[model samples]
Target: MIDLITAGLDWPVVVALLLTSCAASFITAAFGIGGGGVMLAVLASLLPPLAIIPVHGVVQLGSNAGRSVLFLRYMRWELFWPFAIGSVIGVAVGGMTVVQLDPGWLQIAVGAFILWTVFGKTPGIFKRSGPVAGAFSSFLTMFIGGTGPFVAAYVKAQDLERHSHVATQAVLMTLQHGLKSLMFGFLGFAFSEWAGFIAALIVAGFVGTWLGKHMLARINEKRFKLALNAILTVLSLRLIWSGVRLVFGI
Candidate 1:
């Protein structure tokens, strides 16, 4: 019944979340970096504060995993193990210090850096620092719950081709979200009650990702890069504003 699938939330809310999952996946699959933030914004409005990051992590794990599987062939194998190792270490550190530091200034710094990478001269360091990027973004995502843009900014700096860019980002995010989910489980979040709703969200995301792959194939690289940069610019600005608000206690 709708109640079971909604996990005691209203059916309309569940329906809205399902739709968001699909739409957010479509955007990320087609464009490469906006969907997780979109999904997080929507979930923040609908879910309780305590449930947001953990639930978002599970849903993102599913979304990115689907994209990773679909674009497996295009993944940059060289970066995987280093990023994975860094992510493991980062998550371990985040688990221990999740609540110690304030993330406000950190968000501002990340957003500004992303803007610089997109517009100004990108540091050569980014192209060689897969583990560092993975570790920093993974540690930050534990607090902000929306580090796809942070990771994407790094991926973009690599100057990868469109397919490789998307594929590699998907795989990296799958690892990050997977680790975050396990950490949340270790922290005692009850995922059982949300399983049915999360399943519905994942199924919707998969469907959207499948459809979006076709769109991605149609976009020329030049236009894809343009659109991606535009999206990143907007997202970075939003992040900056949020950090400003947090820091100023506005």
Candidate 2:
């Protein structure tokens, strides 16, 4: 069994993983969510349970780094500092504690949280923002690989234009994922073993981001946001279902 599993982790599998990363990155670049969560789901199914979080974190680091570079000019510096600081602290705690907890519950909680954020009716949900909100949301993101919806809500509350919204998210995600990768490394996740795979995914992510940028320019922002909401909704359901199955063994 062990040999079969290890053998399955060959070059062809690596290529498939990279392609998956590329597809996820493209969706994220275009719609601002789904990528990390989707990648996490796929990786969780393929890898040893122990390897899932760190491996997913590393790939996300590459993807978000590419995005941050592509959208560097639109980053809102004021919004960056608080979120970055909180994210660093939160990710450290999360990385240390995650393996000890019931991940199924965590997934359910995160999925429920996303659903609430997307469907809830609360005044000033997107109208109020500052260091406090940024820090809070960034802290939440540490437990979940992708917090694009939360970031988007905050940006929309601030009424940033399309470019600023996407760019700010790209920068924040870059910081979060970078710190996550570092934490995973500290935990002894072997990046060397997966270097080639990571490199391929990074290249694919760059290409996807480039393509997405063009698509972003041509689409109507409202329509894009609507589509994003739908994608997130479906992802949330999948997460919830996966968590339930894990907990129930059904």
Candidate 3:
């Protein structure tokens, strides 16, 4: 069973991926953001180049979907339809181009995006138009694997309290990743071969999310906001450093 679960990799790597899933879910659940970036960085080393994004998409879709369901009562349903429509449009448009970017450039872009999410205000359009925000962010998520910070920034701008913020944002990501994974499958990413591993990871993420939600209930708004910014800053800086090193051939 242990050997089977390892998927031909070392035991440690498999264990790390599981643990990363848990930790990532916890981070995202507690603060309503940051987990996807951590898991994406970790998964890049564990999986082959091609499977990385699609598998990440599946795992994230499950994780976010679970969070959305867990807090479904608080979901602002009015927000869903516009975001969903925009995500579909964005994915269709992005799927047409289908160009692979150099890793360093992508990393730099993601790093810059994270920094913007960390320090930036939600644009006026994002504040006003859910569909526009959805379209743009979903398109961006394709190029850069983690758009949690960006989505969180937009949701925060809606001035939702913590529970609604988390619930609404989870649903938003669930839609984005669902659109993304289907697009990847259409492009022949081979989700089936990795199904078992993906399921295990998603289950782990779900547990972490459950635990994190409990913590979330205890956190006050001010502390939660402070922690969210702090985590985003650290994660963004890490991405920037990684991009710089790769670009410099270090």
Model 1: what TM-score?
A: 0.97
Candidate 2 colliding pairs, count: 1
TM-score of each: 0.97, 0.84, 0.90
lDDT of 3 by residue, 97-137 (tens): 65765657666776676577557865677677888878877
lDDT of 3: 0.84
Highest-lDDT candidate: 1
Please give, for residues 42-104, the per-residue lDDT of candidate 1 as tens digits: 999999998999999999999999999999999999988888988998888998993667768
lDDT of 2 at 102: 70
Off by over 4 Å in 1: none
State the displacement of the C-alpha of residue 246, model 1, in Å, after optimal TM-score superposition.
1.2
Ranking of predictions according to lDDT? 1, 3, 2
Off by over 4 Å in 3: 1-4, 101-121, 243-250
Report backbone clashes per prediction. 0, 1, 0
Angstrom error at residue 15, model 3: 1.5
RMSD of each: 1.1, 4.0, 2.2
CA lDDT, every model vs. true structure: 0.92, 0.70, 0.84
Cα error of candidate 3 at position 195, Å: 0.3
